[model samples]
Target: MDRRQFLELSGAAGGTLLLGSSAAAEATPAVATTNHPKPVGAVTYYTEIRVPPPEKAAVLAKMDELIALMQGKAGYLSLSFKQTIGESTMGRAYPNPKKAILAEALATLDGTLSSPKVPYFYVMFLRFDNYDNLLASGVQAWFKANIVPSLFAYNAATTPPTKTSIALDFHEGVYTTVAAADRVNGYMTAEEISTYLASKQSDEVAGQYVSVNNHYMIMDVNREAHYNLLRENLNGNTRSIFRPIPGDAGYDDSDPDYVANGQPAAADNTFFRKAVTREILQNAFPEGEKRNYLMHGVWETIMDHENSHLDPRFSAGASQVGSYFIAHPVEPFYITLKQDRFIKSA
Candidate 1:
């Protein structure tokens, strides 16, 4: 089924809504192409929710309701309560607002709310219209100042998660509608791209245990022809995916330079597609226990997300989802992951 058709399937039943179905309530969207630029004025939140197995479904339901409620409130934009993927610990960061909002809302409910003793992790993302609006608008500011700050106190807080990183992106002043995203170094040959990533020991790129192991190849394509054609086949809310940062241990500690100052250099699709595709193929996966599936699934999911982002209209905000979070300097080996609830352009 197409994207819209997939939305209907996400619903629980006739006249009933599930978590994924709730996010699909936004207006119908068009297709995307390689020519799309980073969205303008987008502020995204990256966090995780903690819940019990039995209550996981209910908490997720409540999260959908809270998201719908927050949308009604001022300054709130889009949000996603991402389901756990591959490994549970690696899915999303801890202390997510979906979990918190569920708890708070359930606290005021009747019988056995937040009961049955099941535990799950959830992250509530509250995207704003723009970076300025994130801090300026009271509705957005309230969540940051009042709601999101004290999240660390949660019982299931994933402290020092196996991985964590927050990503942010903004359109460069010199960027164009057709300018390609450039990140690989000056390597005319495939060997050079491999050498660049291999010798790369930057704390930002290569850190303890996990490393910047994936390459996302993005391009500019014809809008009406290729973009629209692809839109006809995207199933479910898969368009919600976007290029993720270098880390995924449930912490947003990735260096901000990747997205803040780093982007793929714009070039012909043939060159980028071939070069990035090669770089990704050549990179060595981390020798972790779940390396094989994680590497494959992570890259696949991320590529899917970036490709979906080709449709520029639906993703119309800046810093949508292709940069690393820059909360603090990398200390020694481990970087602290923080929530990027909204953008604050300087």
Candidate 2:
């Protein structure tokens, strides 16, 4: 759909409305292309859902049900659900309150306020085998029949057992993965950062993991020349690189073997078809300082629908590096990007 149509569908007027029969008639979208020499095949559906504070639990339950229904579906790979943590400091991270789904839902419930936070609460990432299946009519039909009813059901009766008004905000888009990188520990050191930038000039790396603070850096020289321009400045920045423990193995002071080989698995380097959406959450420290003491595992799932069509040389594993710094006190916000890649299976 075009930008205008997408805005309306995600707006207050259309937020709570079901996809209905019309969605089943939507023509499948064309596969997106990238500047890369080879074509990629995976597709993703990234959705953002907003619910009132009181309805958070209920909405999540409904969402879980929807996810369960999607299990074992043709071309379906994996689905992840993440919630935004901490209060929003910026004024309306989702602006245009009049056009927001949550705002309109609240107004309908008679629970509207002058300045509601409009919880940009949940983010769902659904991966599929290809763009065609991602937009298939069967999928749309299933949502209309099962998912929509549970989410938008509102009760008008209130005599003995009053039913609360159902309010929700939803926005979604299809995306193809283009490029990704992962760092084992936290952020890269000042020296490592310099090496990374310099290597990109002579390498074909689609993307590179900088630090937990910077996360994955998309390597587009024309679009992101700042990486090269600010190389000198990056060298002086002293943010500690935060690395979580690898697995269930607890940290030990005297275990020499544990100290020698306790790092997590290295991530695979992969590229995608297009860059759909880039979400950067700076600080979602839900666990506070204690979170730092726990081990954190970071991995990427890179898949291509038409894996046979691509060259095998591009599927090589990633290189390793040593830990650079200690974990920062403030939990680092995650950087999530929606992109597509070609893989052998879902």
Candidate 3:
């Protein structure tokens, strides 16, 4: 099923299931402890799931069931699930030419949306007040029993005998919120971002068109220094907001002249709506033991995101931190499917 259908189903299935209270524990913007590598605050279990297009609906149904099961749990704070839009723009060109060529080609095809060769991607976020509470929830156990088997179940009904199961692939990690910002509360406290997001779902669902820019990177600098740099330098709207010229004939994203310096022309783009930064505390996937960070931004539109990359101010600020990157960042865009908070907004 498409995102809309899946969302409608999710709404009907779990809308009233909001459970848990803010008193259990609130994830505040983290403060790094000297002895522990992970920040101190709320913990999040983040997962990326890849499934064949035909199996998307079944998996999502399982997700809704899981959400229902987690309701009223002792420490549960919030849950959000989103689907990729099948569009990815590189923050910088890929180092591997083959991968870059392949990625570029796939973006133009429905393969990213669904295909045996390329599966659809989905992201899930489950937040809790603390590690102990998260462990008590038994969400992992529930997922293993209820959802894991379906991924590996063979479609014996298909024509080819050798074609067995099209099992889904997944990567999971435990993370902490480090820094965040939004238009509603400027430089937000951790609680503020959480509260803002509780109401964010309605706006996204209404528009049916929100752009989430995901920046995945491996950092070489001190984690705290990096986090502070991002919070202080990139948190504001400087050069992020679009300004129009007189008689510019309005914004046209499709115009051939709409690009400047490999990004959307300055005059045609607008600012992002909200942004946050997070760091994996455990179970780093793909690459292990390397410090990994995620910078997430919710944009008004895709063009708003593209335009920000070339802003001279952005370029200058980014250059200071560029050498700290061990690998080129992989940036992709996604749309929210379901977002529900059980905790009271702060």
Best by lDDT: 3
After superposition, the stretches of candidate 3 with alpha carbons farther than 4 Å from their true spots are 1-39, 93-115, 152-168, 187-190, 193-202, 219-221, 237-240, 245-289, 342-346
Winner of 1 and 2 under lDDT: 2
Instruction: For residues 1-346, write the lDDT of model 2, one tens digit per residue.
Output: 2323322432324322111112223322223345222223554565444544334555566656756655546665555554433211111223322111221122233323322334334445566655566665255555445433333323323233222445343444454433222222212343332222222111111342111212111223222232232322222111111111233234443644334322222222122121111112111111111111111112111111111012132111111100211221111122232212222243
Candidate 1: segments with Cα more than 4 A from true spot: 1-41, 88-118, 135-346
Candidate models: Cα lDDT each: 0.25, 0.30, 0.48
Query: Roughly what TM-score does model 2 have, to 2 decimal places?
Result: 0.37
TM-score of each candidate structure, all chains considered together: 0.26, 0.37, 0.66
lDDT of 3: 0.48
Tens digit per residue, CA lDDT, model 3, 1-346: 2323222322223221111111113212222345445434566776665555545677788878777776767767778777765333436543322121222222343532223444556677787766667667887666556645544323434543122444443445566655454442443466654443333323454455444434334433355566666666555432233323223345345543332112233333332222222222322222222455556565555555555554456667767656565544545566777766556434
- CA error at residue 205 for candidate 3, angstroms: 2.3
Task: Sort every candidate by lDDT, greatest first.
Answer: 3, 2, 1
Q: How well does candidate 2 score on lDDT at residue 218?
A: 21
Using alpha carbons, what is the TM-score of model 3? 0.66
